[model samples]
Target: MTISATIDGQLVQWRDSKRYLWLMGAIIPLIPMAMWGLYALTGSTLSWYFGPFFVYVLIPTFDLLAGLDPNNPPEELIEAIEEDRYYRWVTYAFLPLQLVGLIWGAYLLGGGTLPGIEDPLTVVQKIGLATGLGMVAGIGINTAHELGHKKEHMERWFARVALAQTFYGHFYIEHNRGHHVRVATPEDPASSRLGETLWEFLPRTVSGSFKSAWGLEKKRLNRLGKGPVTLKNDLFNAWSFSVVLWGGLMIAFGWEILPYLVIQAVLGIFLLESVNYLEHYGMKRQRLESGRYERVSPAHSWNSNNIGTNVLLYHLQRHSDHHANPTRRYQALRDFKEAPVLPTGYAGMMVLTWIPQVWRKVMDKKVLDHYDGDVSLANVHPRTAHKYGASLEGAAA
Candidate 1:
């Protein structure tokens, strides 16, 4: 669809080339069903692990093959594209499918058999299926992210529903009110530091974000003369959704599925944290005269334009625009030329994060270059400050 707007007495027309491709994100939740179908056909355990293979392998390969998509809608047409209800509907569709997938996965994990299989799955296969479900749970968090940023009440609630699968409901509170406010600063737990491996970042972000979310909610509720434990506390309320969902699933599927549930939830949390680790790795906003960090800008975030990951992740690879305009719909996000570009899409970069040496080799120079070789300007991890000729005081400053 071509959208036109008049700017300075000139007609400007823009068409979103990836309009339909956005549907790929909604299709992610159906991977478990695909897993079942593949298993039914092939009877191979490999089919059960397809979700991880698809996300970690096929998506990265696709990113390399698909290359970049530098298209940006005309400034005049951003609102037009944002208001197009079709885009939001696509995101809404993901929630139902995600719920269905989780329920179906639970049934399978509980030894329930479907039409295609006369025999129950093996323990190894169940573990593979759990990992696959973890992929959906993690990606569902991304879907929740897009919804959580919206102003609509329903969308915010939908965000909580999506998060229930991963037991990460508190992210809705922390990401919007906590991380966004302090991003690229030492205080922002979600922002990764230079020389911090993914192994090191995982526990920090997970635990820190939970604490930060609770604190934010407690402060908010205190103003209303309410305790943090109340349902009115956003953190408490959000977490309740996870408790209720998981509890209900356990009741329905029996207690034996508990271990698999934990496995998927933990893996999902790891996946989300891995993305957080990469988003602002080694980037820091400077302090102002008043001892406050400078406002976040395009420079504070790493960005990618790889079409495959962009489509799969709902343009989340355009992190610069997302931080700059938090409420902007995914379809309307614009790429900034000034933003630091990653070597490839997020999927490929996530793979690099597993090998800290390889990650540092690939990204440390990029950080240095982004700061014009000023080591002190980067968010250098205090322990590795000497490696970069930066004092611990300067790195922590």
Candidate 2:
């Protein structure tokens, strides 16, 4: 669709080239169904691992081939594109498909046989299927993230529904109120420090974010003269959705599917945290003389314009703009030229995070360059501060 507006006595028109491509995100939840079809046709267990293969291998390859898309809508057309109902409907479509896929996957995990298969799946194959489900759960969090940032009540409710799959409802609270406030600082657990491996970051972020979310909710309840344990607490209310969803599935599918549910949920959490580890790795906001950190700017976050990941993740790669304008619709997110650039799209970068040495080799230099070769200006890991000539005093200042 071409968005046209008359601004300051001049006619301006902008057509979003990737308008239809955004629909690809909604198709992600259908990967499990596609995997089942492939297995039915080929009778190969390898088809169960299709989710990880698609995300890690195929998406990265597509990113390399598709390259960057640096185009931003003209300034006057930003409001027109953001208000388009078509774009939001595409995101809303994902929730129903995601729920259906989870139910179907649970049935299969519980030994239910379908038209094509006469025999039940093996344990190994079941684990592969669980891993595939994990991919959907992980990406669903990204979908939730987009919806959660909006001011609409319906969209916020949809965000909680998306998070129910991973039982990560706390993220809706912490990300919006906690992380955004403390991002790129020592206090934010979601912000990864220099020399901190993905192995190190995963546990810290998972545990810390949970604690932070709980604290934030508790404080809000205290103001209302309520206790944190009540349903009125955002943490408890958000988590209630997961309890109903998972508990209902267990009743329908039997207790045997419990282990696989745990597996998928863990992997889903890991996948989301991996993205957090890379988004602001080594970036820091300097403290001022008044003992306050500077306001977040485009320089604080890493960004990419890779068309493949951009289409798949709803322009989430434009992290700088997201931080700058939290409520801006994904279609209206503009890339800032001043932001630090990633070597490739998020999918490719996530693979690098798995190998600590390789990740440091590829990214440490980029961090140093971003800070003009000053280690003190970066968020260096406390254990590795000396290695980077960064003192604790300098970091705190």
Instruction: Give the range where candidate 1 is weakest over 10 consecutive residues by summed lDDT.
Output: 228-237
Per residue, candidate 2 scores C-alpha lDDT tens digits across 259-342 of 999999988898899999989999999989999999999999999999999998999999999999999999989999999999
Task: Tell me the deviation in Å of residue 104 in model 1.
Answer: 0.6
lDDT of 1 by residue, 288-351 (tens): 9999999999999999999999998899999999999999999989999999999999999999
* Residue ranges of candidate 1 with Cα displaced over 4 Å: none
lDDT of 2 at 38: 88
Question: TM-score, each model?
Answer: 0.98, 0.98
Residue ranges of candidate 2 with Cα displaced over 4 Å? none
